[model samples]
Target: MNKRIFSIGLALMLGAAYSLTAFSQVKPETLVKQRQAAMILQGKYWGPLGGMAQGKVPYDATVVARNAGFLEALSKMPWDGFAPSTKDVKSAALPAVFTDTAKFKEAQDRLQSEVSKLVAVSKGGAEAAVKAQLVATGKTCGGCHETFREKQ
Candidate 1:
Protein backbone atom coordinates (compact mmCIF):
# COMPACT_ATOMS: atom_id res chain seq x y z
CA MET A 1 0.00 0.00 0.00
CA ASN A 2 1.07 3.65 -0.51
CA LYS A 3 0.99 4.23 3.27
CA ARG A 4 3.37 1.36 3.89
CA ILE A 5 5.85 2.64 1.25
CA PHE A 6 5.68 6.16 2.74
CA SER A 7 6.37 4.82 6.22
CA ILE A 8 9.41 2.90 5.02
CA GLY A 9 10.80 5.94 3.23
CA LEU A 10 10.35 8.08 6.33
CA ALA A 11 12.16 5.52 8.47
CA LEU A 12 15.03 5.32 6.03
CA MET A 13 15.31 9.10 6.01
CA LEU A 14 15.38 9.24 9.77
CA GLY A 15 18.07 6.59 9.93
CA ALA A 16 20.20 8.45 7.40
CA ALA A 17 19.82 11.68 9.35
CA TYR A 18 20.89 9.96 12.55
CA SER A 19 23.91 8.48 10.85
CA LEU A 20 24.97 11.88 9.56
CA THR A 21 24.63 13.44 12.99
CA ALA A 22 26.69 10.67 14.55
CA PHE A 23 29.51 11.03 12.03
CA SER A 24 29.53 14.82 12.29
CA GLN A 25 30.98 14.72 15.79
CA VAL A 26 34.74 14.99 15.92
CA LYS A 27 36.62 11.73 15.35
CA PRO A 28 40.33 11.25 16.17
CA GLU A 29 41.41 11.11 12.54
CA THR A 30 39.14 14.02 11.69
CA LEU A 31 40.66 16.12 14.45
CA VAL A 32 44.14 15.33 13.25
CA LYS A 33 43.19 16.31 9.72
CA GLN A 34 41.61 19.53 10.90
CA ARG A 35 44.70 20.55 12.84
CA GLN A 36 46.99 19.69 9.96
CA ALA A 37 44.82 21.65 7.53
CA ALA A 38 44.91 24.66 9.82
CA MET A 39 48.69 24.43 10.07
CA ILE A 40 49.02 24.20 6.32
CA LEU A 41 46.92 27.33 5.88
CA GLN A 42 49.00 29.13 8.52
CA GLY A 43 52.09 28.27 6.54
CA LYS A 44 50.48 29.49 3.33
CA TYR A 45 49.81 32.86 4.91
CA TRP A 46 53.14 32.98 6.76
CA GLY A 47 55.63 32.07 4.06
CA PRO A 48 55.60 35.36 2.24
CA LEU A 49 55.81 37.36 5.46
CA GLY A 50 58.75 35.27 6.62
CA GLY A 51 60.55 35.92 3.38
CA MET A 52 59.92 39.64 3.79
CA ALA A 53 61.28 39.60 7.31
CA GLN A 54 64.42 37.87 6.09
CA GLY A 55 64.79 40.30 3.16
CA LYS A 56 64.14 37.68 0.52
CA VAL A 57 60.72 38.87 -0.54
CA PRO A 58 60.05 42.53 -1.05
CA TYR A 59 57.73 43.82 1.64
CA ASP A 60 54.30 45.01 0.63
CA ALA A 61 52.09 46.62 3.20
CA THR A 62 48.93 45.40 1.54
CA VAL A 63 50.09 41.79 1.50
CA VAL A 64 51.34 42.00 5.06
CA ALA A 65 48.03 43.32 6.37
CA ARG A 66 46.04 40.67 4.53
CA ASN A 67 48.31 37.80 5.51
CA ALA A 68 48.57 38.95 9.12
CA GLY A 69 44.81 39.02 9.44
CA PHE A 70 44.59 35.51 7.99
CA LEU A 71 47.38 34.32 10.30
CA GLU A 72 45.69 35.79 13.36
CA ALA A 73 42.53 33.83 12.66
CA LEU A 74 44.34 30.61 11.67
CA SER A 75 46.41 30.65 14.84
CA LYS A 76 43.33 29.94 16.94
CA MET A 77 42.08 27.06 14.80
CA PRO A 78 44.50 24.25 15.75
CA TRP A 79 44.41 24.01 19.54
CA ASP A 80 41.07 22.23 19.96
CA GLY A 81 42.18 19.65 17.43
CA PHE A 82 44.96 18.75 19.84
CA ALA A 83 42.35 17.19 22.09
CA PRO A 84 43.17 13.95 23.99
CA SER A 85 41.19 11.98 21.43
CA THR A 86 43.78 12.96 18.85
CA LYS A 87 46.62 11.48 20.88
CA ASP A 88 46.23 8.08 19.27
CA VAL A 89 45.91 9.54 15.79
CA LYS A 90 49.01 9.59 13.62
CA SER A 91 50.00 13.21 13.03
CA ALA A 92 53.05 15.36 12.60
CA ALA A 93 52.69 16.24 16.27
CA LEU A 94 55.22 14.48 18.44
CA PRO A 95 54.62 12.72 21.75
CA ALA A 96 55.56 15.89 23.58
CA VAL A 97 52.36 17.49 22.35
CA PHE A 98 50.47 15.10 24.66
CA THR A 99 53.12 14.28 27.27
CA ASP A 100 54.08 17.93 27.89
CA THR A 101 50.57 19.25 27.85
CA ALA A 102 51.36 22.44 29.71
CA LYS A 103 54.20 23.25 27.39
CA PHE A 104 52.09 22.52 24.35
CA LYS A 105 49.38 24.85 25.59
CA GLU A 106 51.93 27.54 26.31
CA ALA A 107 53.23 27.25 22.77
CA GLN A 108 49.71 27.55 21.40
CA ASP A 109 49.15 30.62 23.51
CA ARG A 110 52.41 32.11 22.33
CA LEU A 111 51.54 31.64 18.66
CA GLN A 112 48.12 33.17 19.15
CA SER A 113 49.59 36.08 21.07
CA GLU A 114 52.32 36.71 18.51
CA VAL A 115 49.92 36.54 15.56
CA SER A 116 47.61 38.99 17.34
CA LYS A 117 50.49 41.39 17.66
CA LEU A 118 51.34 40.95 14.00
CA VAL A 119 47.74 41.73 13.03
CA ALA A 120 47.81 44.91 15.08
CA VAL A 121 51.17 46.03 13.79
CA SER A 122 50.24 45.36 10.17
CA LYS A 123 47.19 47.56 10.48
CA GLY A 124 49.43 50.49 11.31
CA GLY A 125 51.23 50.21 7.95
CA ALA A 126 54.62 50.72 9.56
CA GLU A 127 56.93 48.52 7.53
CA ALA A 128 59.67 48.19 10.13
CA ALA A 129 57.39 47.33 13.00
CA VAL A 130 55.39 44.86 10.91
CA LYS A 131 58.55 43.13 9.75
CA ALA A 132 59.82 42.91 13.32
CA GLN A 133 56.57 41.37 14.47
CA LEU A 134 56.73 38.93 11.59
CA VAL A 135 60.11 37.70 12.81
CA ALA A 136 58.80 37.41 16.34
CA THR A 137 55.77 35.44 15.17
CA GLY A 138 57.95 33.17 13.07
CA LYS A 139 60.14 32.49 16.09
CA THR A 140 57.10 31.60 18.15
CA CYS A 141 56.16 29.09 15.43
CA GLY A 142 59.68 27.66 15.30
CA GLY A 143 59.92 27.35 19.06
CA CYS A 144 56.69 25.40 19.19
CA HIS A 145 57.71 23.13 16.34
CA GLU A 146 61.10 22.48 17.93
CA THR A 147 59.43 21.20 21.04
CA PHE A 148 56.24 19.56 19.76
CA ARG A 149 56.26 18.68 16.08
CA GLU A 150 57.94 15.85 14.24
CA LYS A 151 60.59 17.01 11.81
CA GLN A 152 59.56 16.71 8.14
Candidate 2:
Protein backbone atom coordinates (compact mmCIF):
# COMPACT_ATOMS: atom_id res chain seq x y z
CA MET A 1 0.00 0.00 0.00
CA ASN A 2 2.79 2.41 0.91
CA LYS A 3 4.65 1.53 -2.31
CA ARG A 4 1.60 2.35 -4.40
CA ILE A 5 1.09 5.64 -2.59
CA PHE A 6 4.76 6.56 -3.17
CA SER A 7 4.46 5.71 -6.89
CA ILE A 8 1.37 7.88 -7.26
CA GLY A 9 3.00 10.82 -5.56
CA LEU A 10 6.12 10.44 -7.69
CA ALA A 11 4.04 10.40 -10.87
CA LEU A 12 2.14 13.50 -9.83
CA MET A 13 5.34 15.38 -9.02
CA LEU A 14 6.92 14.43 -12.33
CA GLY A 15 3.86 15.55 -14.23
CA ALA A 16 3.86 18.94 -12.49
CA ALA A 17 7.55 19.46 -13.22
CA TYR A 18 7.10 18.54 -16.87
CA SER A 19 4.14 20.85 -17.23
CA LEU A 20 6.09 23.74 -15.76
CA THR A 21 9.05 23.16 -18.03
CA ALA A 22 6.89 22.80 -21.12
CA PHE A 23 4.99 26.01 -20.46
CA SER A 24 7.94 28.02 -19.20
CA GLN A 25 10.17 27.18 -22.12
CA VAL A 26 7.82 27.84 -25.01
CA LYS A 27 9.72 27.62 -28.29
CA PRO A 28 10.72 30.89 -29.95
CA GLU A 29 9.10 29.84 -33.21
CA THR A 30 5.88 29.14 -31.37
CA LEU A 31 6.01 32.56 -29.77
CA VAL A 32 6.47 34.17 -33.16
CA LYS A 33 3.55 32.24 -34.54
CA GLN A 34 1.35 33.28 -31.60
CA ARG A 35 2.25 36.93 -32.05
CA GLN A 36 1.59 36.71 -35.75
CA ALA A 37 -1.77 35.11 -35.12
CA ALA A 38 -2.67 37.94 -32.78
CA MET A 39 -1.64 40.52 -35.37
CA ILE A 40 -3.68 38.76 -38.03
CA LEU A 41 -6.72 38.79 -35.77
CA GLN A 42 -6.15 42.48 -35.16
CA GLY A 43 -6.10 43.05 -38.91
CA LYS A 44 -9.22 40.96 -39.32
CA TYR A 45 -11.03 43.26 -36.92
CA TRP A 46 -9.46 46.46 -38.26
CA GLY A 47 -9.79 45.85 -42.00
CA PRO A 48 -13.43 46.69 -42.44
CA LEU A 49 -13.24 49.86 -40.38
CA GLY A 50 -10.10 50.90 -42.18
CA GLY A 51 -11.74 50.27 -45.53
CA MET A 52 -14.68 52.41 -44.51
CA ALA A 53 -12.34 55.27 -43.60
CA GLN A 54 -10.59 54.88 -46.94
CA GLY A 55 -13.94 54.92 -48.75
CA LYS A 56 -13.57 51.38 -50.02
CA VAL A 57 -16.29 49.93 -47.81
CA PRO A 58 -19.59 51.28 -46.59
CA TYR A 59 -19.68 52.58 -43.00
CA ASP A 60 -21.39 50.49 -40.37
CA ALA A 61 -21.42 51.71 -36.78
CA THR A 62 -22.41 48.38 -35.31
CA VAL A 63 -19.51 46.72 -37.02
CA VAL A 64 -17.18 49.50 -35.99
CA ALA A 65 -18.16 49.17 -32.34
CA ARG A 66 -17.73 45.41 -32.42
CA ASN A 67 -14.39 45.50 -34.21
CA ALA A 68 -13.14 48.33 -32.04
CA GLY A 69 -13.87 46.26 -28.97
CA PHE A 70 -12.03 43.34 -30.52
CA LEU A 71 -9.05 45.54 -31.45
CA GLU A 72 -8.81 46.79 -27.89
CA ALA A 73 -8.45 43.19 -26.75
CA LEU A 74 -6.09 42.08 -29.53
CA SER A 75 -3.76 45.07 -29.20
CA LYS A 76 -2.61 43.75 -25.85
CA MET A 77 -1.76 40.27 -27.09
CA PRO A 78 1.27 40.44 -29.44
CA TRP A 79 3.84 42.40 -27.50
CA ASP A 80 4.90 39.73 -25.02
CA GLY A 81 5.61 37.34 -27.89
CA PHE A 82 8.33 39.68 -29.14
CA ALA A 83 10.65 38.27 -26.51
CA PRO A 84 14.44 38.16 -26.92
CA SER A 85 14.19 34.51 -27.87
CA THR A 86 12.06 35.47 -30.85
CA LYS A 87 14.69 37.95 -32.00
CA ASP A 88 16.54 35.03 -33.52
CA VAL A 89 13.46 33.57 -35.13
CA LYS A 90 12.95 34.21 -38.84
CA SER A 91 9.71 36.15 -39.10
CA ALA A 92 8.21 39.23 -40.71
CA ALA A 93 9.25 41.27 -37.67
CA LEU A 94 12.25 43.41 -38.42
CA PRO A 95 15.44 43.54 -36.36
CA ALA A 96 14.27 46.89 -35.16
CA VAL A 97 11.76 45.04 -33.03
CA PHE A 98 14.60 43.76 -30.85
CA THR A 99 17.31 46.40 -31.39
CA ASP A 100 14.99 49.37 -31.13
CA THR A 101 13.23 48.07 -28.07
CA ALA A 102 11.98 51.40 -26.75
CA LYS A 103 10.57 52.37 -30.11
CA PHE A 104 8.93 48.98 -30.47
CA LYS A 105 7.34 49.25 -27.04
CA GLU A 106 6.20 52.77 -27.85
CA ALA A 107 4.59 51.51 -31.02
CA GLN A 108 2.83 48.79 -29.06
CA ASP A 109 1.54 51.35 -26.58
CA ARG A 110 0.39 53.62 -29.38
CA LEU A 111 -1.58 50.83 -30.98
CA GLN A 112 -3.25 49.92 -27.70
CA SER A 113 -3.99 53.58 -26.96
CA GLU A 114 -5.45 54.23 -30.37
CA VAL A 115 -7.57 51.12 -30.18
CA SER A 116 -8.82 52.10 -26.74
CA LYS A 117 -9.76 55.55 -28.04
CA LEU A 118 -11.55 53.92 -30.96
CA VAL A 119 -13.47 51.69 -28.57
CA ALA A 120 -14.53 54.69 -26.50
CA VAL A 121 -15.41 56.85 -29.50
CA SER A 122 -17.34 54.02 -31.12
CA LYS A 123 -19.54 53.72 -28.07
CA GLY A 124 -20.53 57.36 -28.39
CA GLY A 125 -22.42 56.75 -31.66
CA ALA A 126 -20.60 59.59 -33.43
CA GLU A 127 -20.07 58.36 -36.97
CA ALA A 128 -17.68 61.07 -38.09
CA ALA A 129 -15.54 60.82 -34.98
CA VAL A 130 -15.47 57.05 -35.24
CA LYS A 131 -14.36 57.25 -38.86
CA ALA A 132 -11.67 59.73 -38.00
CA GLN A 133 -10.51 57.59 -35.12
CA LEU A 134 -10.37 54.61 -37.46
CA VAL A 135 -8.05 56.53 -39.75
CA ALA A 136 -5.96 57.54 -36.79
CA THR A 137 -5.80 53.94 -35.61
CA GLY A 138 -4.71 52.83 -39.07
CA LYS A 139 -1.95 55.40 -39.04
CA THR A 140 -0.63 54.01 -35.76
CA CYS A 141 -0.61 50.53 -37.24
CA GLY A 142 1.12 51.72 -40.41
CA GLY A 143 3.68 53.66 -38.46
CA CYS A 144 4.52 50.60 -36.38
CA HIS A 145 4.67 48.36 -39.43
CA GLU A 146 6.91 50.78 -41.24
CA THR A 147 9.33 50.65 -38.36
CA PHE A 148 9.07 47.07 -37.09
CA ARG A 149 7.54 44.86 -39.78
CA GLU A 150 8.96 43.79 -43.13
CA LYS A 151 7.38 45.07 -46.32
CA GLN A 152 4.84 42.73 -47.87
Candidate 3:
Protein backbone atom coordinates (compact mmCIF):
# COMPACT_ATOMS: atom_id res chain seq x y z
CA MET A 1 0.00 0.00 0.00
CA ASN A 2 2.85 2.42 0.85
CA LYS A 3 4.59 1.69 -2.44
CA ARG A 4 1.38 2.40 -4.35
CA ILE A 5 0.99 5.80 -2.65
CA PHE A 6 4.62 6.72 -3.31
CA SER A 7 4.26 5.86 -6.97
CA ILE A 8 1.18 8.01 -7.29
CA GLY A 9 2.90 10.96 -5.62
CA LEU A 10 5.92 10.61 -7.90
CA ALA A 11 3.69 10.54 -10.97
CA LEU A 12 1.86 13.61 -9.84
CA MET A 13 5.13 15.46 -9.21
CA LEU A 14 6.41 14.55 -12.66
CA GLY A 15 3.18 15.64 -14.22
CA ALA A 16 3.35 18.98 -12.47
CA ALA A 17 6.93 19.46 -13.59
CA TYR A 18 6.02 18.82 -17.16
CA SER A 19 3.15 21.23 -16.97
CA LEU A 20 5.42 23.92 -15.59
CA THR A 21 7.88 23.42 -18.40
CA ALA A 22 5.15 23.71 -20.99
CA PHE A 23 3.80 26.85 -19.38
CA SER A 24 7.22 28.50 -19.47
CA GLN A 25 7.27 28.66 -23.24
CA VAL A 26 6.13 31.93 -24.78
CA LYS A 27 2.56 32.19 -26.06
CA PRO A 28 0.66 35.11 -27.57
CA GLU A 29 -0.90 36.19 -24.28
CA THR A 30 2.37 35.59 -22.48
CA LEU A 31 4.23 37.85 -24.88
CA VAL A 32 1.64 40.57 -24.49
CA LYS A 33 1.77 40.37 -20.68
CA GLN A 34 5.55 40.31 -20.70
CA ARG A 35 5.74 43.44 -22.79
CA GLN A 36 3.08 45.16 -20.75
CA ALA A 37 4.88 44.31 -17.53
CA ALA A 38 8.14 45.54 -19.00
CA MET A 39 6.47 48.83 -19.83
CA ILE A 40 5.12 49.10 -16.30
CA LEU A 41 8.58 48.57 -14.87
CA GLN A 42 9.94 51.16 -17.26
CA GLY A 43 7.35 53.59 -16.00
CA LYS A 44 8.52 53.01 -12.44
CA TYR A 45 12.07 53.75 -13.45
CA TRP A 46 10.96 56.80 -15.40
CA GLY A 47 9.42 58.47 -12.37
CA PRO A 48 12.69 59.13 -10.59
CA LEU A 49 14.51 60.09 -13.76
CA GLY A 50 11.77 62.43 -14.80
CA GLY A 51 11.63 63.95 -11.36
CA MET A 52 15.31 64.77 -11.53
CA ALA A 53 15.03 66.22 -15.01
CA GLN A 54 12.02 68.34 -14.10
CA GLY A 55 13.75 69.67 -10.97
CA LYS A 56 11.27 68.00 -8.65
CA VAL A 57 13.94 65.62 -7.35
CA PRO A 58 17.55 66.35 -6.62
CA TYR A 59 20.06 65.28 -9.28
CA ASP A 60 22.10 62.23 -8.44
CA ALA A 61 24.53 60.84 -10.98
CA THR A 62 24.21 57.28 -9.78
CA VAL A 63 20.43 57.30 -9.84
CA VAL A 64 20.25 59.05 -13.20
CA ALA A 65 22.71 56.68 -14.87
CA ARG A 66 21.07 53.61 -13.42
CA ASN A 67 17.53 54.56 -14.39
CA ALA A 68 18.62 55.78 -17.81
CA GLY A 69 20.44 52.52 -18.42
CA PHE A 70 17.35 50.59 -17.33
CA LEU A 71 15.15 52.59 -19.70
CA GLU A 72 17.60 51.99 -22.53
CA ALA A 73 17.43 48.28 -21.86
CA LEU A 74 13.64 48.34 -21.67
CA SER A 75 13.43 50.22 -24.97
CA LYS A 76 14.50 47.07 -26.79
CA MET A 77 12.18 44.63 -25.03
CA PRO A 78 8.75 45.50 -26.50
CA TRP A 79 9.67 45.11 -30.13
CA ASP A 80 10.02 41.34 -30.20
CA GLY A 81 6.71 40.97 -28.37
CA PHE A 82 5.03 43.19 -30.94
CA ALA A 83 5.31 40.46 -33.55
CA PRO A 84 2.96 40.86 -36.50
CA SER A 85 0.89 38.00 -35.21
CA THR A 86 0.82 39.03 -31.56
CA LYS A 87 -0.90 42.26 -32.55
CA ASP A 88 -4.25 40.52 -32.68
CA VAL A 89 -4.02 39.00 -29.25
CA LYS A 90 -6.02 40.23 -26.24
CA SER A 91 -4.00 43.32 -25.50
CA ALA A 92 -4.41 47.03 -25.14
CA ALA A 93 -2.49 47.40 -28.38
CA LEU A 94 -4.58 48.91 -31.12
CA PRO A 95 -5.26 47.19 -34.47
CA ALA A 96 -3.77 50.19 -36.16
CA VAL A 97 -0.39 48.97 -34.95
CA PHE A 98 -0.54 46.10 -37.43
CA THR A 99 -2.01 48.17 -40.27
CA ASP A 100 0.35 51.10 -39.83
CA THR A 101 3.43 49.13 -38.96
CA ALA A 102 5.95 51.52 -40.41
CA LYS A 103 4.77 54.57 -38.57
CA PHE A 104 4.48 52.65 -35.32
CA LYS A 105 7.92 51.12 -35.64
CA GLU A 106 9.35 54.51 -36.45
CA ALA A 107 7.93 55.86 -33.22
CA GLN A 108 9.36 52.96 -31.25
CA ASP A 109 12.76 53.44 -32.87
CA ARG A 110 12.69 57.15 -32.12
CA LEU A 111 12.05 56.45 -28.43
CA GLN A 112 15.01 54.10 -28.39
CA SER A 113 17.26 56.69 -29.94
CA GLU A 114 16.14 59.30 -27.47
CA VAL A 115 16.67 56.93 -24.55
CA SER A 116 20.21 56.29 -25.77
CA LYS A 117 20.80 60.02 -25.73
CA LEU A 118 19.46 60.22 -22.19
CA VAL A 119 21.81 57.46 -21.12
CA ALA A 120 24.78 59.30 -22.56
CA VAL A 121 23.81 62.59 -20.93
CA SER A 122 23.23 60.85 -17.61
CA LYS A 123 26.69 59.36 -17.76
CA GLY A 124 28.21 62.73 -18.60
CA GLY A 125 26.43 64.23 -15.57
CA ALA A 126 25.34 67.34 -17.45
CA GLU A 127 22.23 68.84 -15.91
CA ALA A 128 21.20 70.95 -18.87
CA ALA A 129 21.85 68.32 -21.48
CA VAL A 130 20.10 65.70 -19.39
CA LYS A 131 17.06 67.93 -19.05
CA ALA A 132 16.87 68.51 -22.81
CA GLN A 133 17.32 64.81 -23.54
CA LEU A 134 14.64 63.99 -20.99
CA VAL A 135 12.21 66.25 -22.79
CA ALA A 136 13.05 64.62 -26.09
CA THR A 137 12.66 61.18 -24.59
CA GLY A 138 9.30 62.12 -23.07
CA LYS A 139 8.13 63.37 -26.45
CA THR A 140 9.11 60.08 -28.02
CA CYS A 141 7.17 58.21 -25.36
CA GLY A 142 4.10 60.40 -25.84
CA GLY A 143 4.29 60.13 -29.60
CA CYS A 144 4.53 56.38 -29.62
CA HIS A 145 1.93 55.90 -26.90
CA GLU A 146 -0.49 58.21 -28.63
CA THR A 147 -0.10 56.62 -32.02
CA PHE A 148 0.25 52.96 -31.18
CA ARG A 149 -1.26 52.25 -27.77
CA GLU A 150 -4.98 52.16 -27.08
CA LYS A 151 -6.72 54.95 -25.21
CA GLN A 152 -7.17 52.89 -22.09
Candidate 4:
Protein backbone atom coordinates (compact mmCIF):
# COMPACT_ATOMS: atom_id res chain seq x y z
CA MET A 1 0.00 0.00 0.00
CA ASN A 2 2.78 2.46 0.84
CA LYS A 3 4.66 1.72 -2.38
CA ARG A 4 1.55 2.23 -4.54
CA ILE A 5 0.72 5.56 -2.84
CA PHE A 6 4.24 6.86 -3.36
CA SER A 7 4.22 5.91 -7.06
CA ILE A 8 0.91 7.66 -7.64
CA GLY A 9 2.08 10.81 -5.86
CA LEU A 10 5.28 10.94 -7.89
CA ALA A 11 3.42 10.44 -11.12
CA LEU A 12 1.03 13.29 -10.28
CA MET A 13 3.87 15.60 -9.42
CA LEU A 14 5.69 14.81 -12.65
CA GLY A 15 2.54 15.41 -14.67
CA ALA A 16 2.00 18.78 -13.01
CA ALA A 17 5.57 19.76 -13.74
CA TYR A 18 5.20 18.79 -17.38
CA SER A 19 2.03 20.83 -17.65
CA LEU A 20 3.76 23.86 -16.22
CA THR A 21 6.58 23.54 -18.71
CA ALA A 22 4.12 23.35 -21.60
CA PHE A 23 2.25 26.41 -20.39
CA SER A 24 5.41 28.46 -20.21
CA GLN A 25 6.47 27.42 -23.70
CA VAL A 26 3.12 28.53 -25.16
CA LYS A 27 3.60 32.19 -24.16
CA PRO A 28 6.22 33.02 -26.75
CA GLU A 29 3.91 31.92 -29.56
CA THR A 30 1.12 34.03 -28.11
CA LEU A 31 3.41 37.05 -28.02
CA VAL A 32 4.41 36.48 -31.64
CA LYS A 33 0.74 36.42 -32.63
CA GLN A 34 0.16 39.68 -30.78
CA ARG A 35 3.11 41.29 -32.49
CA GLN A 36 1.82 40.19 -35.88
CA ALA A 37 -1.58 41.68 -35.17
CA ALA A 38 0.04 44.94 -34.14
CA MET A 39 2.03 45.00 -37.36
CA ILE A 40 -1.16 44.63 -39.39
CA LEU A 41 -2.85 47.46 -37.56
CA GLN A 42 0.22 49.61 -38.09
CA GLY A 43 0.12 48.94 -41.81
CA LYS A 44 -3.55 49.82 -42.05
CA TYR A 45 -3.01 53.19 -40.40
CA TRP A 46 0.14 53.96 -42.34
CA GLY A 47 -1.33 53.28 -45.78
CA PRO A 48 -4.28 55.67 -45.67
CA LEU A 49 -2.55 58.36 -43.64
CA GLY A 50 0.40 58.29 -45.95
CA GLY A 51 -1.92 58.73 -48.94
CA MET A 52 -3.57 61.78 -47.41
CA ALA A 53 -0.26 63.38 -46.47
CA GLN A 54 1.19 62.81 -49.92
CA GLY A 55 -1.92 64.27 -51.57
CA LYS A 56 -2.62 60.96 -53.28
CA VAL A 57 -5.96 60.88 -51.46
CA PRO A 58 -8.16 63.75 -50.37
CA TYR A 59 -7.97 64.55 -46.67
CA ASP A 60 -11.03 63.00 -45.07
CA ALA A 61 -11.83 63.64 -41.44
CA THR A 62 -13.66 60.34 -41.03
CA VAL A 63 -10.74 58.36 -42.40
CA VAL A 64 -8.32 60.30 -40.27
CA ALA A 65 -10.41 59.64 -37.20
CA ARG A 66 -10.60 55.94 -37.90
CA ASN A 67 -6.93 55.52 -38.71
CA ALA A 68 -5.84 57.71 -35.83
CA GLY A 69 -7.70 55.51 -33.40
CA PHE A 70 -5.86 52.47 -34.72
CA LEU A 71 -2.54 54.24 -34.56
CA GLU A 72 -3.24 55.30 -31.00
CA ALA A 73 -3.96 51.74 -30.01
CA LEU A 74 -0.87 50.43 -31.75
CA SER A 75 1.33 53.18 -30.33
CA LYS A 76 0.26 52.25 -26.84
CA MET A 77 0.96 48.55 -27.37
CA PRO A 78 3.64 47.29 -25.00
CA TRP A 79 6.89 46.19 -26.53
CA ASP A 80 6.92 42.94 -24.63
CA GLY A 81 8.02 39.50 -25.80
CA PHE A 82 11.44 38.61 -27.09
CA ALA A 83 12.21 41.69 -29.10
CA PRO A 84 14.95 40.92 -31.55
CA SER A 85 17.89 42.13 -29.55
CA THR A 86 21.26 42.42 -31.29
CA LYS A 87 21.87 38.77 -30.65
CA ASP A 88 18.82 37.24 -32.33
CA VAL A 89 16.80 39.69 -34.41
CA LYS A 90 15.13 38.12 -37.41
CA SER A 91 16.61 38.92 -40.80
CA ALA A 92 13.49 40.89 -41.64
CA ALA A 93 13.69 43.50 -38.89
CA LEU A 94 16.22 46.21 -39.58
CA PRO A 95 19.48 45.70 -37.73
CA ALA A 96 19.29 49.15 -36.22
CA VAL A 97 16.39 48.25 -33.94
CA PHE A 98 18.52 45.65 -32.21
CA THR A 99 21.78 47.63 -32.39
CA ASP A 100 20.46 51.04 -31.27
CA THR A 101 18.13 50.56 -28.35
CA ALA A 102 17.97 54.24 -27.35
CA LYS A 103 17.14 55.43 -30.86
CA PHE A 104 14.57 52.69 -31.19
CA LYS A 105 12.85 53.68 -27.99
CA GLU A 106 12.86 57.33 -29.05
CA ALA A 107 11.31 56.46 -32.40
CA GLN A 108 8.66 54.35 -30.71
CA ASP A 109 7.84 57.15 -28.29
CA ARG A 110 7.63 59.69 -31.10
CA LEU A 111 5.17 57.42 -32.92
CA GLN A 112 2.98 57.22 -29.84
CA SER A 113 3.04 60.98 -29.28
CA GLU A 114 2.23 61.79 -32.89
CA VAL A 115 -0.62 59.35 -32.91
CA SER A 116 -2.03 60.96 -29.82
CA LYS A 117 -1.81 64.36 -31.52
CA LEU A 118 -3.51 63.00 -34.62
CA VAL A 119 -6.37 61.69 -32.53
CA ALA A 120 -6.79 65.09 -30.94
CA VAL A 121 -6.80 66.94 -34.24
CA SER A 122 -9.20 64.45 -35.76
CA LYS A 123 -11.69 65.06 -32.97
CA GLY A 124 -11.94 68.74 -33.93
CA GLY A 125 -13.29 68.03 -37.45
CA ALA A 126 -11.21 70.77 -39.02
CA GLU A 127 -9.66 69.87 -42.38
CA ALA A 128 -6.63 72.13 -42.06
CA ALA A 129 -5.82 70.95 -38.58
CA VAL A 130 -6.33 67.37 -39.60
CA LYS A 131 -4.04 67.82 -42.58
CA ALA A 132 -1.33 69.30 -40.44
CA GLN A 133 -1.60 66.53 -37.92
CA LEU A 134 -1.53 63.94 -40.64
CA VAL A 135 1.66 65.40 -41.99
CA ALA A 136 3.23 65.32 -38.57
CA THR A 137 2.11 61.75 -38.04
CA GLY A 138 3.52 60.70 -41.38
CA LYS A 139 6.87 62.17 -40.49
CA THR A 140 6.99 60.16 -37.31
CA CYS A 141 6.11 56.97 -39.17
CA GLY A 142 8.76 57.62 -41.79
CA GLY A 143 11.38 58.40 -39.23
CA CYS A 144 10.81 55.14 -37.38
CA HIS A 145 10.59 53.03 -40.49
CA GLU A 146 13.76 54.53 -41.86
CA THR A 147 15.56 53.53 -38.74
CA PHE A 148 13.90 50.26 -37.77
CA ARG A 149 12.02 48.66 -40.64
CA GLU A 150 13.84 46.51 -43.13
CA LYS A 151 13.93 47.89 -46.66
CA GLN A 152 11.89 45.51 -48.78
- Predicted candidate 1, C-alpha RMSD: 5.1
* TM-score of every prediction relative to native: 0.83, 0.86, 0.77, 0.72
- Stretches of candidate 4 off by over 4 Å are 1-33, 81-91
Question: In model 2, which runs have C-alpha deviations exceeding 4 angstroms?
Answer: 1-20
Where does candidate 2 clash, by residue pair? none
Residue ranges of candidate 3 with Cα displaced over 4 Å: 1-25
Q: Return the lDDT, model 1, position 39.
A: 94
- What C-alpha lDDT do the candidate models reach, one value each? 0.89, 0.91, 0.83, 0.75
lDDT-best of 1 and 3: 1
Give candidate 4's whole-model lDDT. Answer: 0.75
Candidate 1 global lDDT: 0.89
Model 2 scores what on Cα lDDT? 0.91
1-152: candidate 2 lDDT, tens digit per residue: 69999999999999999999987799999999999999999988888998999989999999999998888889999988999998888999999898999998998889889888898999966888888899999999999999889999
The better-scoring model by TM-score among 1 and 3 is 1
By TM-score, the candidates rank as 2, 1, 3, 4
